[model samples]
Each structure stands twice: as C-alpha cells, then as structure tokens.
Target: NREPQLELLKNFQKELTNYKENLEKVEDVDSYKKDVSFPKICKTNDDKRKHLAELFEKELRDKFREHSPTKTIYTRTNQI
Candidate 1:
C-alpha cells in the first residue's frame, strides 16, 4: 500500500539528513584541493583556459601513469 512507500520515503529523508549533518561536521581542510601548481600570470581568459587545460592534461597523464607504469605517454606541446 501507499503507507509502506511513505514510510520508506521518511526513512530515506532521515538518512539523507544524517548524511548531510555528518558531512557538515567534517573539518573544512584543503585536502580536497589538487596538488597541481598553477601559473601566476593567468590575467586573461585565454591564459586561464590554457592553465585549466594544462591541469586537466596533467591529471590525465598522472592517472594513465598510475594505471600503466610501463606505457609511454606522448604529450603535444601547444604553441601558446
């Protein structure tokens, strides 16, 4: 019946609230920040885009290296 569905919904809401509270109680640290070093000369939008692209490429290369240590990775250098 609908009564069981309502009870399940209530339980789900309670669990979600508890999860949110637990997340809130966690310390706000910089542990989640990536260790990628960004350039200081990102004054223009193009520069920012290039910096982000570099970060993404670096992350992908790192992941590839982590999964397959023997594989050779070739990165193309941009003219910018």
Candidate 2:
C-alpha cells in the first residue's frame, strides 16, 4: 500500500541523514592523521607498545569507515 511505502521512504531518509552525520564526524580523520606523530623510532618496549596502540587505533578508525553502507549505496546509484 502507499502508506507502507511512504513509511519506508521516511525511514530510508532518516538512515541517510544519520549516515551523513557520521560522514561529517569522520571527514576530519584524514587531516588528524596527517598531524599525528607516529612513534616509529621508539627505543623502549613501553614506547613501542604506545606507538602500536596509536597505529592500531588510527588504522581501525580509517579502515572501519571505508565500509559505510550508505557510501556504497551512494556510489552505486545513478543520478539523473
């Protein structure tokens, strides 16, 4: 029915909006990475562990964002 279809469209719009908001939050991650220091030359074990943690967190944030479903949908759609 039209009513059900309309409800579905509304929910889709809401999801799209949420995705856009998430995109905004992640947009600065690239610049943040550029300015971040990597402990590549750390001498101590503790320093090495800390650098590894930073690297892991950085990679996790950037890589996890690559699988955004909304982004995939946007990429696949053909706009007129």
Number of the predicted model whose lDDT against the real structure is largest: 2
Lowest-scoring 10 consecutive residues by lDDT in candidate 2?
A: 23-32
Off by over 4 Å in 1: 1-38, 69-80
In candidate 1, residue 39 scores what lDDT?
A: 71
| Candidate 1 lDDT by residue in tens digits, 1-80 | 45654565565556555644444444531232256444778665455445555554565555544444333442222222
Candidate 2 has an lDDT of 0.50
lDDT of 2 at 28: 39
Candidate 1 yields a Cα-based lDDT of 0.49
Task: Please give the range of 10 consecutive residues that has the lowest summed lDDT in model 1.
Answer: 71-80
Candidate 2, residues 1-80, lDDT tens digits: the string is 35654565565556555644454455334343465555557655445445545565555444433544354554556352
Candidate 2 wrongly placed segments (more than 4 Å): 28-80
Task: Extract clashing residue pairs from model 1.
Answer: none
